[model samples]
Structures are given as C-alpha cells and as structure tokens.
Target: MMNLAVFASGNGSNFEAVMEAVKSGAVQGEVKLLVCDKEQAFAIERAKNHGIPTFVASPKKYSSKEAYETNVLKQLHENNVELIVLAGYMRLIGSTLLHAFEHRILNIHPSLLPAFPGLDAIGQAFDAKVKVSGVTVHYVDAGMDTGPIIAQESIYIEDGDTREDVQRKIQQVEHQLYPATIQKVIEQITRGV
Candidate 1:
C-alpha cells in the first residue's frame, strides 16, 4: 500500500476523517506521518491517539521557508511517504515542496475555488452573499490554492444561514469528499501495481 503523510496546522478534523477512512478500508493507503508546523496544534493529539507518527517543527526555528521545507522533506523521506495531504495546513507551500511533491500533493479548500481561495473561505463566501459555496480538493501548486482542481462538491448557503452555519456545512462536505477523492488518486498512483 502507498504511504501518506498528512500536513495540518490546526484542529485536524479532516485529518481525523482521513484516518477513519483508512481504518475502514475506504482508502488503500497507510498514514505514515503527521507533519505539523505548530507544536501545540491539536492535530498532534489526534495523531498520537491514532498511533500515527508525527513531525512537528516551527518556522521560526528555520532560517527560511526552504529550510523548513527541506527539514520536512527529510521527515517525509524517512517515513517513505508517497502522497502528501494538506488538511488545514496553514502554511503557503513554497517552490521547495511544490517541486518535491509536484502533483503528488493534494489540498482541500473550504470553498469552491477559485472563488474564496485563501483564509476564512467560509466567511468570504458568506460575506459575498453567494447562494452556493462548497468544498474543493485540488492539486497543490506554488500559488495559494490556485492548483488544478481535482474534485468539487457544492453546498447551498440559505438566506438565514450564519457564517458558522456555512463553515459547518463546508467542513461536513470536506470530511466526506477529501478521503473519497484521495482514494481515487491513490488508485491511479498505484494503478499498475
């Protein structure tokens, strides 16, 4: 089975969802490592609970983004990670990681990009008063959430819906869609095997 390394910077709800998918055999891959930029992130706790190995580092410790990415690459190589999943990973991926992983990296966005492509996407969609907003799973590139789209699922924003309401709906879709899409990508990656 292909090994996966998930990158997360926060609560890691999507990370937990992917773990559930793997546990249930919905995805044919192993979660070999959890990479987190923050030492205090709740994602580390989730990884610990699941017995998944974790690599945590601070950008402040590194001289530059490349330095941080290079260190991360070492951890990925050590774990033999074949796929990189960005689940609420806040850092903007630099050219170092972009070149290293290329199309092998995938990110889940909170909105149906290229609409709200950056932070607080759920709020952006709600503030824009868009009737429809959703989730996007896409290949990660140098640009911020501008990678080629792989999959998208829409959710409607009702007139009375709060921003939190929209956030919850988007997250619900993400928890379901990210794993399903990841499974498809894994199948293609290991198609010949």
Candidate 2:
C-alpha cells in the first residue's frame, strides 16, 4: 500500500472523512501520519483516537518557514510518505516542502477554484451571491489554489441559502469527493499517467 499523510489545521472533519474512507477500503493507501501546525488542534485527538501517528510543527518554534517545513519534511521522509493531502491546512506551503514533494501534494478547497482561491472560500462564494459554488480537488502548486484541477463538483446555491447552508453543503461534497479524487490520483500515479 502507498504511504500517505494528511495535514489538517482545525476540527479535522475532512481528516476524519479521509480516515473513514481508508478504513472502508474506499481509498487504496494508508494514512501514515497526521501533521498539524496547531498544538491544540482537535485533529491530533482524532488521529490518536484512530491509532494514527501525529506530528505537530508549530511555526513559532522554528526560526524560518523553511526550518519549520524542514522538520516536517524529516518526519514525512522517515515515514516514507508518498502522497500528502491538505485538509484545511491553513498555512501556505513553503518551498521546503513544495520542492521536496513536487506534484505529490493535493489540496481540497471549498470552492470551484480559480474563483475564491484563498481562505473563507465558502463565505466568498456566498457573498458573491453566485448561483453555483462547489469543491475542487487539485494538485498543490506554488500559488494559492492555482494548481491544475484534478476534479470539481458543483453545488447549486439556492436563493435563500445562508452561508452556513452553503458551507454545510460544500463540506458534504468535500467529504465524498476528496477521497474519490485521491483514489483517482493514486491510480494515475501508479499507472505513470
């Protein structure tokens, strides 16, 4: 099985979703590690509950972004992680990790992308009053969500839908699409496509 790592920053709902997918054999790899930037992030507890290894790399502890990412890189290398998945990982990936895992990282964003590229994407879509907004799974490039899209699934925003409603819908889609997309990516990589 391929070794995988998940980077998460908050409540870890998506992290949990991915773990569930792995458990159910919907995804064809093992989540070797859980990396979190926040010490107190609930994702750590989630990882622990599921018997997964956890690593915390707080930026404050390192002298530079590269330093922080270097530590993370060491852990990933030690675990032989082949694929890195970003699940609400708030920090922008720096060159240290980016160069180390070029085109091997994936991120699931809460918007169709090329549209609300940064934080609070669901809020951005809601504020724009768009009739349709969705989730995107893409390769993690140097730019902010500017990577080549791997897959996108759109959700219709009702006229009266609140931001919370849209967020909920987007998250539901994320939980499903992210794992399926990851599976497809793994297939492509294994096939050398």
Candidate 3:
C-alpha cells in the first residue's frame, strides 16, 4: 500500500474526508502522517481522533522556509510517505519540499482554477457573480494553484445564493472529489503512470 502524508492548516474537513475514505477502502493508501503548520488548526485534533501521527509546527518558529520544510521532510521520511496530499494546507510549498516531492504532491483547490486561484476562491467566484464555479484537483507546482489539472467538477450558483451558500457548495464538492481524485492518483502512482 502507498504510504501517504496529508498536510492541512485549517478546519480539516477535507482531511477528515480523506481519512474516512481511506478507512472505508474507498481510497487505497495508509495515512502515515498528518502535517499541520499551525498548532491550533483543527486538523491536528482530527488527526489525533483518527489515531494518525501528527507533526505540528509553526514556520515562524523556524529560521527560514527551508528549515521548516526540512523538518517536515524528516517526518515524511520517517513515516515512509510516498505522497503528499494538501487538504487545506495554507502555506506555499518551498523549493526544498517541491524538489523532494515533485510530482508526488497533489492539491485540491476551491475554484475551477485558472479562474479564482488563490485564497478565498469561493468568495471570489461569488463576488464576481459567476453562474458556474467548481473544484479543481491538480498536481502541486511552485505557482499558486498552477499545477496540471487532474479533474474538475462545476456547480451552478443560483440567483439568490449567499456567500455561505457558495462556500457550502464548494466544500461539499471538495469532500467528495478530493478523496476520489486521491484514489485515482494513488492507483496511477502504483502503476508507475
């Protein structure tokens, strides 16, 4: 089985989803570790509940981004992680990690990508009043959400939809799509695709 390490820096809804999916064999992999950049992130708590080992650290405590990632890389190696899955990890991956993981990292974005790429993507689409907005699962690259797209599923924004409504829609899609995409990617990784 592929050993996986998941990174998150928020509420960890996606992290939980991935954990549940893997537990149910909907995804083929073992969650070897959970890496969180924030000590207070709910993802850490969720990881604890799931009995997943966690490495919680703040980049601010490290001297540089490379130093922080070097520490994270140590944990990844210790856990024998084969893939890095970014659930809600808010930080930009540094060169150290990018080089180490390369095509091994994958991320799920809250927008159609090439549309609203950065933070608060759901809000960006809602504010723009776009009739359609969706999720994008992609390979992680150095640029913000600029990786090659693996899959995208769109959702329509109704006339009276609130920002909260849009947020809920994007999250629902994320919870479903991210796990499914991870499963497909893991299969490809196993097949050397």
| TM per candidate | 0.98, 0.98, 0.98
- The TM-score between candidate 2 and the true structure equals 0.98
| Candidate 3 backbone collisions, by pair | none
RMSD of 1: 1.2
Model 1 accuracy (lDDT, Cα) = 0.94
Cα TM-score of candidate 1? 0.98
Each prediction's Cα RMSD? 1.2, 0.8, 0.7
**Candidate 2: global Cα-lDDT?**
0.94
Q: Which lDDT values do the candidates have, in the order given?
A: 0.94, 0.94, 0.94
The alpha-carbon lDDT assigned to residue 73 of candidate 1 equals: 94
Ranking the candidates on TM-score from highest down gives 3, 2, 1
Q: Which tens-of-lDDT digit does each residue in 72-174 have in candidate 1?
A: 9999999999999999999899888888887899999998999998999987888899999999999998889999999999999988998888889988899
Against the true structure, candidate 3 reaches a TM-score of 0.98
